[model samples]
Target: MTEHRIITIGREFGSGGHEIGNLLATRLDIPLYDNNLIRMVAEKLDIREETARAVDETTLNSFLAGFIFEPIEESSRLNGTEYVPPLTQQVYELQCDIIRKLAERGPCIIVGRCADFVLRDHKNCINVFICADWEDRVERIAAKYDISQRKAADKIKKMDRERRNYYESHTGQEWGSIDSHHMLLNVSRLGMDRTVDILERICR
Candidate 1:
């Protein structure tokens, strides 16, 4: 905490990244930004939280872009031409701005939402990527959601794909590439409590 480090955590689905972030934040006495960002973006755009959540960590399909986003106003048109960005893209830009401001403010932890890439230039930023064994992830998801293993596996695949697409599209980097992060952790092996302890020590 002496250096006011900014920690950005990226994780595979069901890897306990958010929970780890929450624990680290509590131990470090710093704020954590995760789903709370969805609310902030929702308020800024005057849209429902659900609407923001729908596009929070996914890219908008080109074919459905027009249907999902309204036309741009004449004054707001790019070079007098209709050039509306997808709602997902707009939300990302807004989130990037907000993330930058938060990092500038002080030490904190930001989970997912491509925060690592967003704060890449920050001098004290520590980017982490968390992954786990497939079976471990499946069990975690099933137990947490009270769903069948098959259903949990399906959800995990879908969520990870969306997160991968979103991150690659915006950052032009592999989602969990070792080159992109300062640390690559296997939470299943470390255990959530041990993972939190390690990260807390890193922050300190």
Candidate 2:
């Protein structure tokens, strides 16, 4: 019941969580951040957007940090080969810094990339998880992307898996677990506008 100024939304694939975040930001007259943060990370790291996105919200970030790169060993073996932290590690660390800075700057809506965990200490940040029934998720994704329900379901499965792995790896918490969020919203039931309205009231 604290006055939450920054909002972080963790959502299942195709649950309209992104849409809800955007609407909430608009209504609040604040910036909304999603994939845009990826671009920022990409630019800061001097890597292609596609490269940064390749590891975005996936276990590869941590996996590659410890396993995929043998830069230290390789450096000793090869002699004078500069060692850099894996790009995934850089992106994760940099993204965390960005998230914290954004929280400090002002109120805003941020979606995914483990923003909830990044700002867990913030006194006025609300972490929300958005979810929907599978059938409902498939319908929403299908309509939004103009794809068949079957394909939409497949897409949802893959994305949800990646996000789950990413969040669990970074936060040490189960993605979408009820305890992890201040509130769990079923956009399937509340719909986007009402969802925004409720969150808006809560943000007050």
Candidate 3:
């Protein structure tokens, strides 16, 4: 619909959610934000992209916080005498700001980073959750990363856990719950092209 100015996709690992976002963005002539946010955050904080990406869509428990290096800006803000949140929290805050700005700029496809919750008050946004069969996910991940199915399954489990924790921590809501999203699609069931076609139609 014309009112759909922003689309946020929440997906399971290896579910083809990112691919759908890419296809939809291209078909609609809009911007797509995903891993590129890591680059932006890294540049903004003057940190290594790997450093930024390590915390992306992941959280640090108190026990793990001891190992994370605080952003230079955060450390120097109060002459090293103030309490700064964990690097993961700071990254999440920065991402929220970036997501808001991008949404304000124009229509775009934002994949993950809890963009659906971040833009909860934006009237022109549509949030979609994507899932796939376990075997399908395993196969997709294995092919994508050139890893064995067992390794792919392990990676999927880890990533899904991190994403779920990150989303729940920041938004205080379940990551892929039906009530949290406007639409839920099974990419493995519908196939990539058909899923993209449905989303493109929805955006129109």
Q: How many steric overlaps are in each model, in order?
A: 0, 0, 1
Q: In candidate 1, what are the lDDT values of residues 100-153, reduced to their tens digit?
A: 999988899999999999888788999999899999999999999999999999
Candidate 3 at residue 49, lDDT? 89
Instruction: TM-score winner between 1 and 3, please give it.
Output: 1
- Scored by Cα lDDT, where does model 2 land? 0.85
- lDDT score for residue 139 of model 2: 94
lDDT per residue as tens, model 2, 46-105? 777887788888864354435333335333333655665666677788899998888888
Score every model by TM-score: 0.92, 0.87, 0.90
TM-score ranking, high to low: 1, 3, 2
* Per-residue lDDT over 1-204 for candidate 3, one digit per residue giving the tens place of the 0 to 100 score: 235489999999999999999989999999999999999888886778887787888875544333455544565445657556667877788989999998988899999999999999999899999999999999999999999999999999999998999899889998899989999999888999999999888879
Give the true-structure RMSD of model 3: 3.0
lDDT, model 1, position 21: 93
- Among all windows of 10 consecutive residues in model 3, the one with the lowest summed lDDT is 62-71
Error of 2 at 86 (Å): 1.8
Cα deviation of 43 in candidate 2 (Å)?
Answer: 0.8
Query: Which sequence of candidate numbers ranks them by lDDT, best first?
Result: 3, 1, 2
